[model samples]
Target: MKTANKPRTSGSGTKRNGAAANGKKMPDVNGPAGDGKRPSLYANVIKQFDKAADMMRLDGNIRKILASTMNEIIVNFPVKMDDGRIEIFRGYRVQHNDVLGPFKGGLRYHPAVNIDEVRALATWMTWKSAIAEIPYGGAKGGIQIDPSRQKYSINELERITRRFTFALGNNIGPEYDIPAPDVNTNPQIMAWIMDTYLQMMPPHERQRCIHVVTGKPIKSGGSLGRDKATGQGVVYLIERWAEEQGFDLDGSTYIVQGFGNVGSWAARLMKPHGAKMVAVEDVAGALYNPEGIDPDDLIAYAKEHSDIFGYPDAKPIDHMAFMGTKADIFIPAALESQITALTAPMLKVRLVAEGANGPTDPDGDRILLERGIHLIPDILCNSGGVIVSYFEWLQNKRSEFWDLDEVDAKLKKKIVSAYERVQGVAHHYKTDWRNAAYIVALTRLENVYKERGIFP
Candidate 1:
């Protein structure tokens, strides 16, 4: 698959420092206060890219490609609410790169969705796939409709998804752009997209196109072990890191910030490793227990109680308190920017593993590095989703499926290997983990671009 290449131009030559060419404005990104408000998400992303580019002494041309997204689509559409009122929703999709292959990422739904967030996320996806050594580029889409506010029935959501999919037209395809699940979206949502795409295609061409969307239900051709892939991958990386550090998992305490799919599954996986989960925080509330909460029991309780609070055997705690709780490892499995400078200094953990994209802001990350916290960068740490999504896409295209055990084994091997590689890069660069990860990904992307060369 190929996309039209856009010519690169130097953006304000006066800002032509190695980092500046990467489109990062240091003064604008020094902190959330630099702008008198939170730093722009896209700016924060570019700042990191710039830091990495500066470290690598990357050429301007490659920096340009890495710094900017290849394509961005915005759509405004109306959906009939349950009250029979038509509500307008804004949606966005960003394809960051296609140098490796087609763009692959997830679609999110939230009231806070915007073009800047999508672009930043798409750029992260590009780095993520590159870091994982996956044969794919990066893209992301989101609709700015609060799923909670949508009192519409399932039919309305399906209609909204189909309409948005149609607006994408040829922009998204099995061989062009593929989207899975992200914030406020899930496999059911993906299935809606696939069904809509299939309905739009000629009947005979449908079978060849089912691979266009991933993260579907297993009955709908989703890959086995897909649901737990991301969390399991985190555990896999933790084990590898533990082995390298000569730390025992048994009796080690962990605190997970966010009791969502990634956090819950990670907690469950750690249970079998003999690791104790000391605290877990969710949108509703948080719970803590120094003796360790049994994940199985906690999960059951959360399901029954509708939140983490009020669960028997665990004391209810404030959200901020969970951040400062002492633990061997801390996993931010929640939204981006949750671990800002204000929160980082309070974290009493030695190891920080990101289960969400950009969970640590630039200032927060610097503070963590200063304090000698070993952070598993999000790109490498949470890449199991894309890796397994790649497998699911391949299976759909080939009409073959692997069993759960096979999928688990492959996911473990891939994540563990990537972890080792990133660890080596960190040591070689004598830098913190996030910068080390960026170095590894930038090197791979640069080599590919150099070999491919520019085309007329």
Candidate 2:
């Protein structure tokens, strides 16, 4: 078992060192422009935390600790390509805090992966776990390579994943830090990570470490509802909101930004509610159909065509027009800083449910607040994935498997409880939902810190 407060070393015997090694420098967070007109992703995260901390009067010491990551693990590992060439790839695993429990989050693979983005996501994971009242802290990992853009063959992808896992070594463990699926990652990738991690352990210990990563294939110890957890969580919150407002979901129109796992699942799940998806957007293009585009059809087409660009039922629509489309609900499940100040004004939705982390910047948040557009913040809205991941981890630890119905019921209960807590905090403090969520999480962590005083 790993010792508390002890940093895990990589396979190379180095601990938490990567940025400055080998004459490589960490990128300037302020980008090339450096005009300060746009803040870096991590900067925006700190701003949010500061706002909630000031409002809640968080403890100075704890605030200082939470303001920065506890561990930033960077590794530059080499992977062999299909063309008989070796390429060096940089990977990151940022552990923000573990005051609540073990560090828990997802591993994403994207071209834009950077320390700032990973740090921001890791910080959010800590808040997400606290808000959900789960016994997990926060962490996030990523490899700086676009799985699609790089055109890596399956063999190359598997090799890269295994090499990255081997590099992570003890830094990730079933009880220390567990990774699940995020952007451009899925069960197959998770299986590779788990296998690679298991192979690094003794034969007897390997069996106990099947859950070194969550979101694996069910046969590989993944949970039944794990795949749809985040989207299901999003829909659950939306359902609760609709019930509270006495709004009929039947025949309501909605738009989705990003047709990936979360967006597609959320859209498909909303079908039973009789809701219609009128518009959808992704990295490639946008689609619109006032009569409603079928989620099942779009997803199937996307699976085959690799995008939602040419679905016959929906006509091509520009981003501006798509955002301006009349709808009762808008789900931004795409990249960070998507719904900025410029795009926020174009949204004609009654609600903005963030499925992606940091989809709204400070300026966009102000616009939404000013426009009275209700929002279910990313921390609370997209927490189902982690909640179900917790369930999976528990199951693996105990050698048990739950059916889909059981998983869904448990997820609903946990997320709804969190929602109620946020709602109560919002009502009590008379604040926005985002601020209310942070307050709830910060209050929980603050109490924990008070109870378990810091060790010398």
> lDDT: which candidate is best?
2
- Work out the TM-score per prediction: 0.87, 0.87
- Mind giving the per-residue lDDT tens digits that candidate 1 earns over 331-429? 889888987889999999989989987799888989999998889999899988889999899889999999999899989888887887788988898
- Report the CA-based lDDT of candidate 1 relative to the real structure: 0.84
In terms of lDDT, model 2 sits at 0.89
Question: Which 10 successive residues of model 2 have the least lDDT summed?
Answer: 1-10
| Clash list (residue pairs), candidate 2 | none
For the record, the alpha-carbon RMSD of candidate 1 to the native fold, in angstroms, is: 8.5
Q: Write the per-residue lDDT of candidate 2 for residues 1-456, one digit (tens) a residue.
A: 222222334456545333234322334444432246776678778888999999988999999888978888887787767765667778889999999999998899876787777888899999999999999999998998778734778898999999999988999999899998888999999999999999999998999999899889999898899889999999999999999989999999999999998999999999999999999998889999999999999999999999998889989999999989999999999888888889999889999989987799878999999999999999999999899999999999999999999999999999999999999999999999999999999999999999999887
Clashes of 1: 0
Model 2 spans > 4 angstroms off: 1-40, 78-89, 110-112, 146-153
Cα shift from native, residue 407, model 2 (Å): 1.0
Clashes of 2: 0
